[model samples]
Target chain A: MNPIRQDFPAFDGLARPLHFLDNAATSQICRPALEALVRFETDDRSNVKRGVYARAERASVAFDDARKAAMEFLNAPSPEEIVFTSGATLGLNTAAHILQERLQPGDVILVSLLEHHSNLVPWQLAAERRGASLRAIPVTDGGRLDLERLDELADRVRIVAVTHASNVTGAITDVARLRSFCDATGALLVLDGAQRAAHGPLDVQELGCDLYAFSGHKCFGPTGIGVLWGRYDLLDAAPPFLGGGEMIRRVSLERSTFAPPPHRYEAGTPPIGGAIALGAALEWSMAQDWDRLGAQERELAGRMLDGLASLPGCRIYGDTGTQQRIGVVSFELEDVHAHDVCQLLDSDHGVMLRGGHHCAQPLMERFDTVATVRASLAPYNDGADVDALLNGLEAVRRKLA
Target chain B: MNDALYDQAIIAEARSRTGAGRLDAPTVTAECDNPLCGDRITVDLAVQDGAISDLAHKTRGCLLTQASASLLARYAKGGDVAAAGELRAAIDAFLKGQEDERFAILTPVRNAKSRWDCVTLPFQALADALADLEKRG
Candidate 1:
């Protein structure tokens, strides 16, 4: 396997090099994907699906090819099943608006506490609009989704949107179990794959999700582009989210006929450069050896966790084992503000990490803390990064003492 | 980690409790907080002859916030209640660039001018608490 650090170019310019542990917020762009973005704008710039000229036709083909490649990347049933939106927020808002319209008043929408606010707020708006009952599937004490309670609540649920991995706690959920539960209840299952898509293998058919949404930027592609993979039948049945030029087949003063499936959801000029870059990113990701990447991160996380545990008053949250979690690890120090810890890491050790509620406010309330300092890893992160964070914390503790 | 932000003297002040301006002694102490950035301060003062006789503060957050509270505590001890209110305006004007020389004495609190809410958080709590104290007496 190629050295994972070689995949990213940003690290080459650093002096004494800083360790970046904020991948959950956004991953550093890979060199190949950045090149793809530049090539698209410089060499192949044209409006897609419209112009009959050679350049326009070529652009259209590139756009369609990227869509098809994304379909293959997600193992989606068809190219038409994917709808490109601005990002996961827009995709989820579209899903929520459509689902809310379909569900009658008094129907139930069951979400989980583990969901990001993007996933939770949209559904809450929908539930409030339709007078639907909203329920939260409890999380286990260890931070896993409580499947036992889910079985009991299944009958009342109309839609179940869950995070495949927790952003704060780094707890991985059992998607197959969730799928089975949703299937038995005849409820639609939507997976928030924003955190899982690049890190883990995903097959929509295998996961049994009716719809899945993930952002391109979080997976080393450019921002402002994301993909929503829905079963073709569901896409056909759901109402279009926005109306504009590209989404209609015919228009008249009186009435307009809408286009089919993916185009029906894509209303205006799409993010052509972003989609092309994302396709390149997916290509790079697929070529990687998962075993090496996962093992390296797991080993790095274990070393960090062990070092943190050895500290006098360090307290960690969620699952510690790599088998049950992702690369993101969160912890708090006794009598020290998380912000202080993050500042010290950056100033003293050149380690960049996130310290705040992480937009997981409910999780913070559940854990009974105002905030936590999180260190998330990418494939490029090595043992040195882990050492830097631990040593920085030790220095902080000594100075504070 | 920068000495300019958290100097040794500031750390020493934070660690010490004497004349820390803790309001626990006041019969009508007031505490205020800026929940967004976690800056907090409690004001302790004794009012006699319809004038401010004593004032002090216990503060935390950035240096500017602490320094602003320290400045307020010093001036408020002998000023009348109206004078204390007037000082808020002077500080607000100084923060807004109405008086440039006034800023020199308030340099430690200048960084928070852009982040006005943080710098004035302690003063806000003290003002409200003082109003409450006057109401009760």
Candidate 2:
């Protein structure tokens, strides 16, 4: 974690030793990303696509460069396939909206129990609006998608939307299985890539997904910026989600024509600086040695799982193994409430943890738990972070349970 | 930080489980959920005139929520709806860090602003119950 920790500002010069184990919520911004944000704001503070001056042209160039970076990071076929959004929530909403017209009554959108609310609700709205329906792919006790049941569930599924990686259980979905299902049924695949984006560069083409949505902040970029990538053919055929300046081809009193895919989706002025920063963040991520970082993450995750299981009355939700999972771990102590556990950890142990339904209420129900304490790891987190979390849980149990 | 927010007294109050049930025959009942954390409080009341003859609570939440439920029972068990009204003010004061002898155990909670709803959910259900009863009559 040495060189990785040095690049993140959150670990710098802390008065009290702070262990940030809440990276699933938002990772700390890296130096390059933050510098990119500042550079955009200070050096080129002008509107994109609508200005002629040098600063405006510079801003526009930087903005498009960021788009190219994102396109390359996701391994998207073209830069035009990338649409900058406010965050994953909005990106998913745009995905739903763009795909809405294709859905008709009796059509189904298959989502899994692993979804964050951002991934679940927008499709629900789309289903409801189109007189279509949503069917959840039941999660196994291990918290992975019960993909064995996919044969029965995919009959009416015009679209299969699911998480690339679960924020709660840390289980990575078996996308190959889903890819097969979608291919056989001709159901479009849409991935909520929020959690998986943090781990490494994505290959949407390789994953066999038509559209993908992910937040920048969770990938060491700024908030209020995210990316939605869709195939050119699908995007070209889709309706405009938002109608405004950059998104329109021409406007009249009664009728207005829309621009192409990405622009048609990104209405109004985009988060210029935020998008630039996210690109820088993606570039920074691509520059890292994922093989080394990934092993470090897995080792830390195993320790967290084993340590939590060792504690009396402690239960780890989802897969307890390091295989096919990210470093995000959610667990609970008997009798002690999740919020209380988190509060005590932060106040007493200086460990920052997130506790709640994790915006996946259905997943919580799947686990038959009220709330859970989640410790999500990033590249900068080390053994000490895992130690503090385990120690904090022990202290919390002694005090409360 | 020296004064632990989850001190002994608060723990005891939560452990007591005072008013931690449902009234079999209730004049009115209301449920409230702290949407942020999914902490829930269901309050049942037996009212005679404008007074709450008895009350019970089912709080499926954290320690602060349970402790607050217990405190709501302790102070407002036999009191009128107006007295329950005053308790809401007291909770507001406690949250504002103002001194209330009975609720002093929760003073430390003022600094933990995110947990404020946990301490207020029971009282909010009671308020809703009272308002619902009024609407019924």
Can you write out model 1's per-residue Cα lDDT over A269-329, one digit (the tens) per residue? 9999899888888888878888888898789989988998898888898877778788888
Segments in model 2 whose C-alpha atoms lie over 4 Å from true places: none
Q: Give the TM-score of chain A in candidate 1.
A: 0.96
Any idea how many clashes model 1 has?
0
TM-score of chain A of 2: 0.99
Docking class of 1: incorrect
Residue A191 alpha-carbon offset, candidate 2, angstroms: 0.3
TM-score of each: 0.85, 0.98
CA shift at B79, candidate 2, in angstroms?
A: 0.9
Give the TM-score comparing model 1 with the true structure, all chains together: 0.85
Model 2 Cα lDDT, one tens digit per residue, A224-301: 999999999888998888778889999999999999878998889999999999999999999999999999999999
Location of the lowest summed lDDT over 10 successive residues in candidate 1 chain A:
A1-10
Chain A TM-score by candidate, in order? 0.96, 0.99
Worst 10 residues of 2 chain A by lDDT: A1-10
> What value does DockQ give for candidate 2?
0.60
lDDT accuracy of residue A96 in candidate 1: 86
Clashing residue pairs in candidate 1 (N, C-alpha, C atoms within 3 angstroms): none
